[model samples]
Target: MEVGSTRSWDELLPDALGLIFKNLPLQELLTVVPTVCKSWGKAVMGPYCWQEIDIEEWSNRSEPGSVERMLRMLIARSNGSIHKLCVSGLQNEPVFSLIAENARSLRILCLPQSNMSDSIVEKIAGSLSMITFLDLSYCYKISARSLEAIGKNCKLLEGLRRNMHPLIMEERLSQDNEEAHAIATTMPNLKRLETAYLRYINTIGALEIIHSCPQLEYLDLRGCWQVKLDGEYLKDKFPKLKVLGPYVVDRYERNNDYEDWSDFSDSLYDYESSDDENRFGELEFRFYQQFNEDATNGWPPSP
Candidate 1:
């Protein structure tokens, strides 16, 4: 109320500062905000700011091994109170184990494009009992076995995204509906299921899921060329359910937001065919190259 009054931002409480810091990017939170003042630094270092850690953007642009190190640091800062975590490009086993050990309150976990395997899924199922939403899109290594384990363990789960790349002609012929059956039998509580771009599932699998998961409110079957839906049947049986029909090439051609063929522009997707045994090797090479370039130029500026 005075003409010459001065306000000190550093005097703000840690909880208030944390609410403000939550809006900032992970990179800025880690590097810029902390250096402003002692109070800001303390707030950034506390568990409040690390409750919902989303490193997807930073992980995509950062150097190799940097994402893992940053995850370790941030998870430690959270002090086991992390509730939602979204990460990409993870290939390490120990990091999954670390999350299982520490993040007991985790409810939403997104690991899109990560190299997670079925064994790892089994290992972490026990720790994921509290999870409500999970995203495993583009995780080709995961199978029906892992989905069974997840459904059994994560009783509270209501959302699942298990999207995949469209299968080649030969692979599609031999593909089974085991995954759909697993989801249908075990994950009855799911309300939202996204199985986009999965060429393996047919009408049988789709019917199985629709019949089993009676609570489903939203179902996405885009790019599933084999699954043919009867519109009248769906409307009569499940009037409240909303579904996205199979992919129509011309429909998504003008829509950039659709992820059906979004990754095809990347070099990695160029080798995504079943015959490409060295795909991971190439990915590692690219990661290492990027890291070397960043190190030489002093990227991230030591924070």
Candidate 2:
């Protein structure tokens, strides 16, 4: 990549640039290519590329407000071409408002590790009729009332990820139970479900998800320490599932021996096209409880 003189949009190749950007991820273009020159910047900020965004951050990146700045620019430049948004961090309300205000076209949204509120989720879910995938991992503050809104409007939804903390001492336990049950009943078309690392889970809650999403194929239940499935009976219910518990892709996990009651061959998925099928891998789950809020912010519980 090199520096070049800026050119006016009248001479811009919007179509060619769109094709180029279609292959580039959001994070890479916003930081590197878009900053190179005004011509490329205008092309990159065009509606076609900005409409559907995928932001991925690697381990060695810094510059606190860079992503925020880019997303804001895209929203302003594209005039709400953004429909399918995939984000990977905590975003404030201003950014959310940018998308929600022009959210009519949004279909799939991935906001893992977001610290979200119920009102915001309701607004987006209520407004976006075409939404299919909604991933909200590490957003521990979500409640059942907001989830109801999602089930109502996002009927065409195919995948949902909502893992938050369970309230043990609340008088709203009954409310929690019924709401959880309603989620299963409402989102019938969901094919993939995921949650964050939970120290424990009620068996009824677990059962509700399995029975509700009868067509479920990919399940990520990692970090759920207290939720145990009957290895024997689960064979019948979970035969189609491939991933279980939490998502741990780097480390190797050993599957625990459990009672086998169903035929695995009858339900296992074949995600690959005949020409592209190569890898067939299975992951196991693991977790721990409690961490210190240290005086100097030190993390404890070392293995």
Candidate 3:
């Protein structure tokens, strides 16, 4: 942090080097220090230190390219050992592709803001069969076809969250007549399920998700406005589901019409806390704190 700290860092041994490197910020650790020397470069760019990637922040919107390029670094560093990743609010398509393809070693993937599709999700399921935890909240474009692909392929899947901005993707799933059983039969391994922004969907889709993903110990339906919910149905269908939260957001924008809408206060926290303590980690909190409060005009209340 200072000239003296820099001098002390120069004197650290290989064992101590990782500590110093770990102490450095992610961007600085990956960028600035490598320029110092070959030893530092070789030491810093190893598989052990790069086993996991967490681009938990995309606040610096000015250099979106740099953030997208980090996906390359992450894929290369992962080298088939990457265990967990949480990339939120990304715009690049290649980043999504590389994440789905090269991260076959992943056990958990929490891409909250990726604008991905069923094809990419199919690729992920085909590649990363060992995956257990997956969250795709806020990605509204994803369809039931993609969900079908996810359920079919992720056999070991334990926990899943597939929330969306209901308004952003209202055009995707409008049918009140679609069969829900087909999608339900695909994902039978889910131990936890969280869905929101589901205004367009009917009880059939809700029943499909509930009946199919019976292993759920946790079920969250914050903003499932359209689905007819009842404790009896949930209790009968999801016997093991110990936690359930179904919510309705008071403020909403429909059909891209924000002209008459009054904005509600935004919170990084959605619904209520299901975990004993706050679910967010320190780095994750720091990340979200930077930029998560934009007035989302096109965002749907449920999907």
Best by TM-score: 1
Cα deviation at 295, candidate 1, in Å, is: 30
lDDT of 1 by residue, 1-303 (tens): 599987788988888888889999877988999899999999999998998888876787775499899999989999999888988778888988988887589988888777789999999999999988888877778889999999999998888887654432225546789999999999998887878667678899999999999888777775677788886788789876766646332221111112232122333221113333233233211121223454323211100
TM per candidate: 0.79, 0.66, 0.68
- Candidate 3 residue 49 Cα shift, in angstroms, is 1.8
Question: Could you tell which candidate, 2 or 3, scores higher by TM-score?
Answer: 3
- Alpha-carbon local distance difference test for all models: 0.74, 0.56, 0.58
Candidate 2's residue-wise lDDT over 231-298, tens digit each?
44666556666545432233223321111212243233332223212222343322112212232132
Q: Whole-model lDDT for model 1 versus the true structure?
A: 0.74
Q: Which stretches of candidate 2 lie above 4 Å from their native place?
A: 1-13, 25-42, 58-66, 163-179, 246-303
lDDT of candidate model 2 versus the reference:
0.56
Model 2 TM-score is 0.66
Please give the range of 10 consecutive residues that has the lowest summed lDDT in model 1. Answer: 250-259
Best by lDDT: 1
Clashes of each: 1, 5, 8
